[model samples]
Target: MKITKQNIRTALWVTLSVLLVTLLLQNSANVNLRFLHLRAQMPLFAVIMLSALFGAGILWFARRRR
Candidate 1:
């Protein structure tokens, strides 16, 4: 196949995805978290994903409000 910008972008994305999965797998350990009166334990990756979603939700809400 001929080399193209789109192909390169797709390859990069696939590589990054593989790397991300590897990283998550490597960090398969529970962590303790507390928020105000709430407390829980979860895997590192789950905590990160939840934080990202929370940030994105806040950002989206702020942008929509403006």
Candidate 2:
């Protein structure tokens, strides 16, 4: 199978879309970490969205040469 720009773009879109939906459904969940007595509660949706955006940007930059 040959990999192409269109294939990559489509995969990225699908992945991001799935992440977005998953986050939306699990927005109320809270994650806890214990380190030096520091606790943080964050919205999962925001994290997923940001991650997806960053991934998209990186993918675009990496593929610009092709």
lDDT winner: 1
Candidate 1, residue 19: Cα displacement in angstroms equals 0.4
- lDDT per residue as tens, model 1, 10-47: 99979977876787778779999999999999999888
Query: How many angstroms is residue 14 displaced in model 2 relative to the true structure, after the best TM-score fit?
Result: 5.0
**Which sections of candidate 2 miss by over 4 Å?**
1-19, 30-41
Candidate 1 Cα errors over 4 Å, as ranges: 51-66
**True-structure lDDT of candidate 2:** 0.76
lDDT of 1: 0.86
Give the clash count for each candidate: 0, 0
TM-score of each: 0.63, 0.47
Clashes (candidate 1): 0
Clashing pairs in 1: none
For candidate 2, which ten residues in a row score worst on lDDT?
A: 26-35
